[model samples]
Structure formats: structure tokens, C-alpha cells
Target: MPRDTPYLQVADEIRARVLAGEWAVGDKLPSRARFAEEYGVGQSVAQRAMERLIIEGILEGRAGSGTYVRKARERRRMIRSRIHREGGGSPFRSALKDQGSAGTWECNSRARIPATEDIAARLAIEPGDFCVMTHYEFLADGQPAQLATSWEPMAITGGTDVLLPEMGPRGKIGVVARMRSIGVEISTAIEMPRPARATREQANFLGISVGDLVTQLERIYFDSEGRPVETADIIVPDIRWEIAYEIEVDDSRF
Candidate 1:
């Protein structure tokens, strides 16, 4: 390695040690002084090399404790898109007409259950109100890509045409369209972004490591008067999807 590139070389060596299973998870690394002695370098040089790996999210340093390897990094990304709805009457089932090749939605029905305190707060319902849960798994290119669960008020959607297979829009159709069909005008949408590790259930569904990191998107939709219409939680694996946002500025005042 070149003289000025020693830190990177040291980092590469440590990474190899990790991949080769020489240093396992939770294993403490050699002290900085020991590493410097082993590599025939100053303590400052070894410390710098360790710092580089830490910044890359490969190593973690605990305050007052020695540095150690972090849990392996997982590859995941998120893509969030927003759309605005117009007009009064409900959109046709043919709104599916434009998205091409009708997307398939797998559905299952179960008994009403009480919402957690957080869920109840978000849905604006009683703390223990029972809810009808609808889960939809979306697939594209014949691969499982997204999973979503929607919660609806048991009393409102309990006996309507809302449960029909053809009720929503096309391509992972959201709850907003379904509400519109039933005269519920959704005027606001809230989406929460978070990084999470895949649960065993998610790992099996997405065909990834159990510890892999994934994106969790929780959303709440509201009617025009601000009553909660629906709430949904979606899990997206990192290997396949990403979230992008754009900012536009008008330079007229500049």
C-alpha cells in the first residue's frame, strides 16, 4: 500500500477479519495501543484507522468502553410519492385503467381487535375501540415488494360495501380511494418514516435475513372535517426500494 494510504489499508484488513469470521460479533477489538504495536504504527495512526471504519458504520465506539464491530450494515432504501385528489363523485373502478396490467391484492379477514394506545391516538378513536383490519401484500415482477395493514372503525365499515375486493384503486391501492367510494372524503395524509429491523415474519415474507434493516412507513388518512378515516402501516425491504424527495426553489427574489 502507498505510504499515505495506511489508514485505509488497516481498515481493509479489519473488514477482512470481520468477513472471514476471525472477529465475531460482540468481540472486543485489540486496544488502540495494542493495534499500534501490532501494525508498527503510532497510536494516533491506529486510532485514525479505527475512526474511519466507525464513520463508515462498520465499527461502533461506546463511551468509556473499547471500540467494537457493529451489527453488519444492511442495504435498504425508500421511495415516497404523494398524489392529490380532485372532484366530488367517486372515481371509477376503471381508475385502474391507467396503471396498466391490473395489480393483484391478496386479502385476509379476521375478528375485530382493540388498538394499542398509539394506534388509538392516531386513528382518533377510543383507546380500546375494536377495529377491522385489512392487510394487502403487493407484488411486482412476481416478487413480494410491499406489505400494508389498514385499520378501519368497526362501526363505520362493519357492514358496508367497503370490504369488497374491487373497492380500492389499482396498484397497491390506498385506503383513501376506498373511503371516497363510501362518501368519506379524505383531505389529509400523514406518513412517518423509520428505520427498523425486519421481524421474523417480515424476513420470511421478504426473503431476507432476519436482522436485515427495512423501512417502516406508517400513515394516517383523514376526512375533510378531520375525522380519522383510516390508518395503515407498511413495511418495505431495503434491497428493493428507496425513497426520494425533490426540493424546488424560485429564484425571482434572489
Candidate 2:
């Protein structure tokens, strides 16, 4: 069996203390030098142990202040459903409605941008194909809650009033409605979600620490003809939201 390193040993000891109620939630942890002297380890070792705990969500570091035991996060439920897509309008609007909070958003739309290989694959278009991309920052009750970047093939909306997602007659209406206005009937949407670490930019946008866990969702919408019409990548901070999928069971199964 592999033996525990000095830092791991120190981390385990500290974790035990926390679980034993030696330090309550929001209590400041000992400084690096103090921990080192207590554990008979180097200051670097003690610091590394604390960093591990921070990444594990057991502690948090405040700039210009010391590290403290992290409080339990209050997570709101984020439900994804066809009902929401049809009735709730935007994802941010739906999430806020579920939380009983008001939603506000900022968006920027870029038209006729060339799609990269990955985005082209998702849209089922050739690489370098022109696309309309919109970036969004969403807040609920004045707190940053979600970030999304949506891409649509220009082939579908080119020369249409809905080409720019945030402007024109059907602007800001949403994917299903906007496409319907353009004579396209959206029939299905597919979403895949996975856990990931937040990047520095994402952390800054979501107001969380870098390396904090987040939920990344890849969603694609298709028309009746099975052609990919739109796709988006959404980021939700794990500490702030818990995702729920509302899947309807087919009656024929019974």
C-alpha cells in the first residue's frame, strides 16, 4: 500500500478536527506557520494541505483575509423540460421563475462568424461555415447564475429578421419561437451535462473560485427534418444550482 505523504497526513488530521467540531463553519483556519508548527511539517506542506481542502469544498480563501471553513452552499433546483422550453422562454427566465426570483440578462450577438470544427460538428455544418453566435450572462435576483454561448447556422436564418438572436421582430423570443417564425418547426432537443472545473474566466463571471466544480451542458435543437438548427454550451456554478431533468414516460410503455 502507498503511504500517505506528510501533507496528506496533515490534511487528514485537519479534516478530522473539523468533523469533530473543533472548528465550526466560517471559523478561520490556522495560518500556514501555525499549522506547520502544530503538525511538525514545513509551511509549504501545511499550505498544500489547506489548498487540497479548499478544492474539496471544505474551506475557502478570502483575498486579503485568511482561509476559513466553508459554509454549506444553498443550491437551487434547475429543471430542464419540454414544458419549460415551450412556455418558460429562456433558460434563465425559467430558472428564475422556479426560484421565485426576478431574472435579468445581458447579451451580445455576432453575425456571420465562421464556425470552428467543434461548433460546426454540433451544428452539422462545414467547418468555417458562417454562423450567428450570441453570448449571454444571466443573473437571478442580481446574482450571477449562468453563462451561455449559442450558435446557429446562417443557412437557416440568413436574410431573416431573426438572424440576430437579440434584435428584430422576433428578437429575444427564444430558439423555438424564433425558428417557428422563420417557417422551421423545431421538434426535439437533446442535452448532455457533465461536471467540470471552472476556468479563470468562468470563475470571474460566476463569482467563484477557480477550480470550483461546475455543471457544463451541451444542448442541440433539431427541426422536423432532423437537421441541426441550433446548439449551445451552458455553464452553471455547482455551488449555486442543482440540475433536475423532467423526463416524461411514454404511456405506451405500460
Number of the top lDDT candidate: 2
- Winner by TM-score: 2
Candidate 1 lDDT over 1-254, as tens digits, reads: 13256766677777778778887777778888988888888888789888866754578898999998888654333334344335312221123223342334576655477877888988888887988777777665455667778787776666776754234332234566666667888887778879988888887777654556778889887899989877878888776667553234569967
Worst 10 residues of 2 by lDDT: 83-92
Taking all chains together, the TM-score of candidate 2 against the true structure is 0.75
Model 1 spans with C-alpha error above 4 angstroms = 1-79, 84-103, 164-173, 245-254
Error of 1 at 136 (Å): 2.3
| Model 2 ranges with Cα > 4 A deviation | 1-20, 23-71, 84-87
Q: Candidate 2 at residue 9, lDDT?
A: 83
- What are the models' TM-scores? 0.57, 0.75
